[model samples]
Target: MNAREVNTLNIVGGRVIDPTTDADGRLVDIHVVDGRIAVIVEAGGALPSADSVLDASNAVVSPGFVDLHTHLREPGREESETIETGSRAAALGGFTAVVAMPNTDPAQDSRAVVEFVREQGRRAGLCEVVPSGCITVGRAGEQLVPYAELMKSGVTLFTDDGNGVQDPLLMRRAFEYSSDLGVTMAQHCEVSRLTAGAVMHEGSCCSHLGLPGWPSIAEELMVHRDIELVRITGGRLHVLHVSTARSVEMIRAAKADGLSVTAEVTPHHFTLDDESLRSFDPVFKVNPPLRTMADIEALKAGLRDGTIDAIATDHAPHADHLKEQPLDTAPPGMLGLETAFALSVGELGMDLRSVLACLSWNPARIAGIADRHGRPVAVGEPANLAVLDPGVGWTVDRRRLASKSRNTPYEGRSVTGRVRHTVLNGRAVVIDQVAQR
Candidate 1:
């Protein structure tokens, strides 16, 4: 956080579940001073002076979340969302850091643009915004962006998110250089040729509705292709928004084969099915369209079995009128940053620790921010943390949301879990479920 002068902050009576320290459900008190963990005392045995104390009773205090995918829509599309508003939403959702996507007006291809986005996030003083660079210049698939140049700006993740790299040879060349550069090439996994004018998942739902279907094969093909490419090139490849059963199986096998590959699934894919499109609301529409129940089950199995590396929000915010358009013409996305954790906890049926693994440490490592973002709540560590009440229940209200756009699919639906507070770099950015700044 950009809060320069951090006061002594004490968070007491929370069940500390730090995977970094092998702590599971241990009740403790954490003292943050000078933007670092100063002391950690066992519950009921704390004698630490503090300027402010946050009662974290009945809550799980862990490292703050890091989103591998978040669309802040800055630099050009401020009508949809801004860096400040998006960071506010992230803080409320218990995220201390978020990887800002590169699909902007000028595209985050150069150091200047990515630096601008990072500066805007710092100006907001909410969450740490790490801007990802475009894999291709201008997010156009013709030429590769200067990875080495952009890396100087602290961009470790590169992806042409709105579309996949169409050329296999070009992708291979990118992989060859990525390993040497110590960076990751994340693919959108959709071959545009296959998804021309496509709407929802190509299934029975589309058959009855008489609308164009975005086939599952479109994503699976690219996932398989990238796995093979990684097998040959020996570079890190990350498949984004994985949605198909076959894709999950392929990634699991690739990992077994010792390929440097990682994949992430969105909350919408695992929580909602293609059947939700029955209402014909464009809000249900999203890229890598929602799949069948079988696919959802496979996604859950992957997460439980440690096949999926993370649960990224893919938090895209579109303007009001854009999502109000017809399903065929509307943009394929939904507001996700604020609701991803609860949706995952409610739908996955996994234990709280496993759920946190997907939401916190796992994604943090993937985004390459582990040095600061995803760390244990122990002494001498950065004080980035999320305090969660797993037993709490809440419903979404469009007006109450911190996001600038209102395209959330769960507008009135009840969801489990709530972020009680978010501490970013020794500052409590969110306290008792409210953004402090």
Candidate 2:
């Protein structure tokens, strides 16, 4: 992977979409030298010396995607996922970086957990895996985790993701500390009081299935509370995996008020609905469980008109044993890394740049990895990119996914668009819909 030994590798005949530079996804040729973009010349234009070349003739080349939330399941639950497996899945999903959630075995509330996850990602050498810190001691949601200590260890976002901080005063104090430390506080946005023992979204669909429902208020109430807290503390608040219509309206109004607030919606939220849960498939089970189609439309609208800041995968993975239990008793989650891009393009129906903004640049800025990972395709930039065939249509075969967990609801479902190639640091980790390494 050394650059000096390999002088240059040219990526030609691709549509370059560098939103930062107004590339606008036009067809061009990109030359990589010493692991950096040497030049982006016109198609068939003069190119630098090269030992290799990637044919991206039918692909759309854009900055690599950054997942604002990914559960790598390392240090605690390797049976479900590891840094290596998750990163490979991410690469296949057109992601260059992922923020590993802190709710691991030892819980990334301490520096030991934080450093171990970062080192593991480095050792795996698959994708940039940034570790998040817990907002409470041991993620117990009781006492706050040492935010200052975690920040010192390179942690950027703090959350007890599996559970929201139930104590309003404690959450308020967390925001106060977050403002001083300059790290973002991301909330899972569910009121435990309302969601206790609930299996799916509370709605007509849930009533018909006779399943206990997780009311929209469970999520919206917390979102509403957090937005008000952000206004008071002036701390950066990022709402994670928002799943309800009212939640979107709350975030939209907060933005309208010019608050320092940002939010992300999972692909499932915008694409699927609670109706999927009627099958009793645990794969459809998730926190902030899938809402009704009306909610789905609102989520899509939020993404379409820019009210939503990013499209986070919330790529939670679970072991088969965990997910095999009855739908009501099973742990909530599903595989996402390998399906985010296609799902977005197929369901959202927006231009490529807007989609990439949610998948790439916008999330990078939120995760604080913008400088190296989300840059445009041009001279003097790192060769981190995804080449996708925007018009390709395909069905998701869960068995073919790179993740150890196969809990995706999209199995056997036809979807449009596909990631043809993914280049990370000048190497084609994925080429022609296949992972190289």
Candidate 3:
């Protein structure tokens, strides 16, 4: 496909909810030509004959979502996920782009690896896959990678996701070095010393189950340290997968103080609690383990009040048998890309616009991908949009997911809201809840 070519597509009779253009709740028809929004008229308005038409009555037409964090496990771990499968899952979740994490086998520290990942995403053609750089060499936590080099290679976000930068001094220097690079330092936010052998959140749940606890303090300590570091270094910091009450409060306070700090919370953190661990399902296991109901409420409040900027999926995928291992032995992650929209809508208790903002626009700005993604639904803009049914309810089936792995914790859970059609670059990658590819 050429850069300026797309099938003539028309999305008819849908409520357009674009916060950027003050078009929320307006019934509009979107026309796409050559991959750009050619016109938006009232529902049933006449227009040029389109080869493709999607009846979106009672649905929502909004900017396609952008996930700030996603593990596309390629270049080494294709057994878990590749850019193509992950992009398919993302498209089904209404995401037009996902920032690919740097925790792969070789770790995306070099420009060669970074370009390869970006090129693979291009080949997939499902969604935009933006590669992130490692904060440290090979994400080893001891030495810093070349930020200028990575930035020139088009990576604006950097992180050591599976492992937080354990050394405070090293983290401080990372922020300092980022001062001139115009990159954001994203932290996984676990103090390694505090979470050495932990499996679940520290609380009565762990005590009752006789399991090692991953305490909230381990996350809060790093949150506090990174905030102070940003305060001093005047560099931007993005806290990834924040899961604790105190961590939320500290991030709220840091933002109030006018620091350039942003944060994201995973759907699993807000939708499930540590009590799920009582069932001994390794699928519930995650790096930032699920916390108490109190923490879930706090996270919901954070999203409601804008303390947390984006609702990232953390979209970690593991092989079937890997997640089927005993809790203590299994890898800590769960499939998220396909279930995030349903979980967020049914659980957040917020209005449609705010919820979509957290899922789309907010994360787009954070990931620095607002130019091509998360833009308003209007004429002359790229037609990257998600047609959503906010009131539809469905149950998740792990076997039917587009992801290469089947480790979703939301399996069998009933949820509302679904991505009906996902139009990426003006072509329907997902139509009627199915990936066209």
Candidate 4:
């Protein structure tokens, strides 16, 4: 072994599932050195000498997951979360990189803010934090931000995530500009006109609760608008946290039409319904509120059939005081970074390879980090990997979360999959199911 990796840790005897090569999970031993994969030997192969050896027998090792959408809430709202704490939560959840949402103090519209977010993430060194620039300055939806300058700052995606660009003309202009800059534009997919004063999904649940209603049409109409915009402008459009059945159908049709479009669904959307709000817990209150059981089934089908591209944790963290507010008044978000993978594995019911593809490979490609991450477990690839114990079931503990906020709806909920270890850039960031500082 080279000096850089002679004493480094080696992971062996795990079922490696790398979707890039269509390699179904198989028993293998992987040696990592100098922040890259040095060798991937079959089970019972000759052992390589290293400073430390991790016995991952009976576990599943795969590429670290990539989250295309994450709200770290740093810079402006450190009370909610910071880069360090958020990265810790992401590492525990088996993610190596999380695309930071731009809805921060002053917003991530200008080149300066984008650079600040990237620098903060680098300072933490916990996970690769990519910042997404806002499509409109301050996300007011009035004017477009400097897309080229932001992209030059290494921003691969743009979005006014908390709010969609309301003006059709402005959105079309954004698509045209995004196409030129080669950065993807992700949409929140809500029509303010229809969703104004809305609290939850406009369904039997909302009516029974006597709450303000957010209609499926509000989300569906904007989804349709953006799909058509993608067709006209020939730019990449990514629908974020899609919740409704009709919206899925719209995206399915758009894909059939050959538009460069992609979509992601949150864990709560498929696992929980609007009825969770019957108890009046604000933790279950989310922006694109939960929908009907039929919608849930359709979303699962979309994911299983490859109609959906990635399973991004729209991991929005809100402070306790904020989440404790009245359901209608409280901000709509929940802690997700630490719980996404377990929820995905338990709810998706797919093979290990398929689940990793949705969580790791597909999102890595979408976020433009696939070159360094999401590679097959082979020699010469970057050593960004996660080992998971699939049979170990555990309950969610909100108090132990690394993130500053603990607004998780899944608190105390039983989950099957747990992250055993995470190796990032040849460093054991997480070892033996614990975060290594």
Clashes of each: 0, 0, 0, 0
lDDT of 1 by residue, 1-437 (tens): 46875589999999988775443679998888978999988987855788888889989998899999999999999999999999999999989999999999989999999999999999998999999999899888989899999999999999999889989988998899887888999999998888999988999989998878889888888999999999998889989999999999999999999998998999999989988899999999999898999999999999989899899999999989998898888998989989987998788898888888888888888888999977877899999999999879999898789999999988898999899999998999999999999
How far is 409's C-alpha from truth in model 1 (Å)? 0.6
Better of 3 and 4 by lDDT: 3
> Please, what is the TM-score per model?
0.98, 0.97, 0.98, 0.97
Count of clashes in candidate 1: 0
Please name the candidate that would achieve the greatest lDDT relative to the true structure. Answer: 3
Give stretches of model 1 more than 4 Å off: 1-6, 21-24
TM-score of 2: 0.97
Q: What C-alpha lDDT, on a 0 to 100 scale, does residue 269 get in candidate 2? A: 89
Off by over 4 Å in 3: 1-6, 21-24
Which residue segments of model 4 deviate by more than 4 Å?
A: 1-7, 21-23
Q: By TM-score, is 1 or 2 better?
A: 1
Q: CA shift at 355, candidate 4, in angstroms?
A: 1.1
Q: What lDDT score goes with residue 35 in model 1? A: 80
lDDT at position 298, candidate 2: 90
